[model samples]
Target chain A: MRRYVFFILMIALGIVIGIFYAQEINPVEIVDAPPNTLRADYQADYILMVAEIYALDRDPAQAARQIALLGSDPPADIVNRAIVFALEQGYAPNDLILLRDLSEIMRTWNPNLQLEPGGGN
Target chain B: MSLPLRPWYLLTGLLIGVVLGVLYAWVITPNEVLETSPAMLRSDFKSDYRALIALAYQSSADLGRAEARLALLEDEDPARALAVQAQLTLGEEGGTRIAQALGQLAAAIQAHREAPDDPIIASLQAGVQSPSQATSTATVPPPVVRTATADPAGQPTATTTPSGDAENGGNPTPTITPTGLPTATATPGAPFVLLDIVLECNPNIDPPRIQVYVTDAAGSPVPGVAAVVSWDGNSNRFVTGLKPAFGLGYADFDMDPALSYSLRLEGGGEPVDNITGRVCEDAPEPYWGSWRFNFVQP
Candidate 1:
């Protein structure tokens, strides 16, 4: 009878320890994006696309090409403006495409887009 | 089962366990945390006070540099003059970073100020500034200035559109008296204005509110009338509640993570808007806690 009672006490202690271990939580384990990560601008699409391309490989011309494909409606300085915007955003080619649709929408908007006319060694 | 059970053993065991657990918690726990409370509070206060003081120093330094740069331009340096103007604008905008640092430091200090006078806390406060209440505060008076009287009442009044030394009204040859005060003087041939905004917060107190100080083209404080502070996140505009303004301007808002922010000041019959230039968001959470900044007029 005494042995059975001791066994029950050991089991109860184990359960309490297990519960405490399971319940422990880290307060700082939140996965939220840093502030000002995204901007709401017409050229942001080009910037995002350029970042994706740059991250994969360093190709300013290819990035420029991707930017030129943004939308059918052309802002006067569209390609050059996009290039500058992309550079400012520090878009690398490998960056994950967080806003793919936004890029696609921009491409559909600028149909006559072409690589900025002036670039080479 | 029917026998009388006093259960004395169970009660005694529970009491002993509780007492032992408390003793272990008090003695075995890290002493660093226990000893750090007072020093930590004092350090926090000093940090906050340092923000305001550092800002005061930076502004004074920038003002001096600007005046010197402008004075050099008068000796025929047009290119240098343009560079000076750009530098001044950068310096003016940079005031925000200083202000924010000061706000955090001040909040920490206020916490120490309100804590009970434990010897450790008292010693910490004393190590920073004397702990005695009598030494905490020492009052001083504003400087006296003598001016020629036009009106029989002899009340000094500032005239609008002051220029060409005529504003002094025959009180020519102004004397420079430095009594450890911040002053902004506009030199001839290179006029400039600096607006400083001071924000104060006491987390120990109720809801944290930021105070905005509004000054004129001169460093002199602008009083009366209210200014409205509006931001991009909130729909309603936050109007300043206090008056005569202290340094530049003040507005309070709950801290948020968004880096780019816009501030608009509309009051005293004029409206000015500004955008923050490249906020440093990727910093230690502590550094990014709270920010105080100033908006200078264009």
Candidate 2:
């Protein structure tokens, strides 16, 4: 009886230790993601909204202010970068034009400042 | 060598194993599993991830956030990567949407560059000592600021009226002038209320075309009105009194079937019409596309 009880306790102890070791080895726990997070499509839509507003107002300064909400780069640099990015992204001609027009308008509005050269059409 | 085992010992061992196994499987294991790495994500969700980053940039406008989000996809150049993906997938139904999103992203970036605190804006403001000073210093006459006239509701109101010469003649001259330019004796003047816009797709022509019509409050077609059509980053100005097939109020422009287009009457508020290209399905005579827009004075 003593031997049997001793063996049973030993087995239980081994399992408990094994569980602890397994946890230590792989500590990652699956977690649920938070809700209300923005998706990529939503982000793209926001960008379109900004472009529409810029086109409507033709106010580079105001447009820049709104764009600054997205990133730290100067508006002109951002525009130039965006142009290159858009072209690289294979954006439609009309969509590219909207960005280009904004860039041109910005350049026209501030000729003295040197803006980054745009890449391939 | 097998040890002599008792039934009680065997039963006890079995029970212990079962309980512990269940506990380990249920309580010890994590609830969520990360099935994919960033590398795997790039292969699977490259375009979607890029679009999300672009969209996120709009709300946050933070390059760092954009970078971090892009990093999850292991992309080195977020914009360029998206552009490449867009190009690769061009003509696919989803391609248009991706391209549009990319363009919006670029526009947002450009807008950010023009912010008030930007040196460029500051310099421009500083350089302009006065309106007179600016005008005097400029080599050419300052471009007129043609703000689109907005109605009480803030919507741009485009009105078409016959030019002084055209109005004098009860019957206007031929639609196309001797020089081959489509001429409309329309001047930008009285505010004709814009009633509606109609879009028609005609695939009979080689590159498709968009025809526009302008009318007055009495529903009579207004002749010699000017309209501007813009698409694929280019703009063309045309006038009514052309395309006699659609009558004096009608004007038309050839368009690429693969492209979408927007139209604004010369005195722009917002674009009066935006037409998306649809596949032409004329048996044995498929052409790119076409559209028609109707505008009226309220």
In the order shown, the chain A TM-scores of the predictions are: 0.26, 0.48
In candidate 1 the C-alpha lDDT for residue B226 amounts to: 32
Relative to the unseen true structure, what is the C-alpha lDDT of residue A55 in candidate 1, on a scale of 0 to 100?
Answer: 37
RMSD of each: 26.8, 23.1
Q: lDDT per residue, candidate 2, B176-228, as tens digits?
A: 11111111123456444455443333444556576666654434344445577
lDDT of 1 by residue, B1-298 (tens): 6224324433444454544444344444322223211112233332322232323323222222122222221324322222223223223545434433232222212222233334344334323421111111111111111111121111112311011111223454533221112222213343122234332222332232333333334322222113344557543233221111111122344434343344444432333345222233343432323334343333
Candidate 1 is graded, for docking, as: incorrect
Error of 1 at A39 (Å): 64
Error of 1 at B52 (Å): 36
Fraction of native Cα contacts kept in each candidate?
0.00, 0.05
User: Runs in model 1 with CA error above 4 Å?
Assistant: A1-121, B1-211, B232-251, B267-289, B295-298
For residues A1-121, could you state the per-residue lDDT of candidate 2 as single tens digits?
Answer: 7767766775676566556555665444423222112233222322433554455445555555555543565555656766665565554554466667766655565424533333111
Q: How well does model 1 score by local distance difference test? A: 0.31
TM-score of the second chain, each candidate in turn, equals 0.25, 0.34
TM-scores of the candidates are: 0.20, 0.28
Q: After superposition, which runs of candidate 2 have C-alpha atoms over 4 Å from their true positions?
A: A26-121, B1-28, B32-47, B58-60, B73-81, B88-91, B100-298
